[model samples]
Target: MALDDIRARIRAAEAAAGRPPGSVTLIAVSKLQPADRVEAALDQGQRVFGENYVQEAQRKWPAWRARWPEVALHMIGPLQSNKARAAVELFDAIHGVDRASLARRLARVAQETGLAPQVFVQVNTGAEPQKAGVLPAEADALIQECRQLGLNLAGCMCIPPDDADPRPHFQLLRETATRNGLSGLSMGMSADFETAIAEGATHVRVGSAIFGARPTERPG
Candidate 1:
């Protein structure tokens, strides 16, 4: 199955990059995938998953979590400040913390609930207006803000422009994380995970490759 194949590739990539095996975590992106498929991955011993929508996850994950209590779910999509508390309660890690407002909200929620998820500030390496990430130049300040707010900031994440080479973007994210004393690099998707691993990615979010493509119309 693709889950096993992806893990094997990760191990091989780690060896080629002279990194220790199990250094990188493969987040099986379960967003928009069917329950049966996600359960199949659980049966295959995949304990880490990534989701994009808070409501979708809220609707599905609690039931799934009851069965797979050890699963770690990551929020890998744009997070709204309005959903901060829910996100804090649901995710083990959040990879889309990109703004001050969202960070502040997350901080407040954490303070109220005493539950904070590991966070990765999303950096807009391409400076794409439509993208939901902090500008590359401002990522430092955002990281600092998150830290000051008492959020558990683990690292930096980026989604390179689809049309351009992702290696440079990956390198940029790695450098940002390194300068901030962060160790996690949550870049790379199915197409360029190997390159991301070479560039020091500690977590790679692979969806379609593992779960098959998401349905065109998500079920209500």
Candidate 2:
């Protein structure tokens, strides 16, 4: 019933934010979770899931997709340029497009395959040195570049500083998306999704709250 609870919370957040019901998409972050956990969520009508790694998704999702054809998979972690083709082929949306090189690669893949996933430019609102997103100051250029590349530039995504308030970061992402004429805001996770929804997040990636904790050691 955790999935249902999370959905209920999302609905409440939507209502409280004065947004239309079902305005926010809940992407169950299933990366690193056990197959059974994922299946249970799928059975509960969770059709959208987020994965962090291309290889992991490739290994596990095809069979699952065969069984649940309506499923929508999203790439929510750092995406490497080398994996752009696979990510384009496998995911319905990519939420970590943070650089021009990756954007160009995605465009090339789209040209080759005649298919491209919706993409969100990742913004490092916190300006964290170690994070894998474009800095807030550089977001517009990247967004412009992505649009120029003929990619389906949907919106913006962000991971706020771990120890700081996330609402400001969410606000920055929302503002950036608005300036770029984008509507999608993939800027929330389990801990701060409500705040993100309040700040106009169109997609919230929630993991542990839905599927429980991930194992410490990932299988190769």
Task: Say what the RMSD of model 1 is.
Answer: 1.0
CA lDDT of each candidate?
0.94, 0.93
lDDT value for candidate 2? 0.93
lDDT of 1: 0.94
The weakest ten consecutive residues by lDDT in model 1 span 211-220
The alpha-carbon root-mean-square deviation between model 2 and the true structure, to one decimal in Å, is: 0.8
What's the residue-level lDDT of 125 in candidate 2?
95
- Stretches of candidate 1 off by over 4 Å are 218-220
lDDT leader: 1
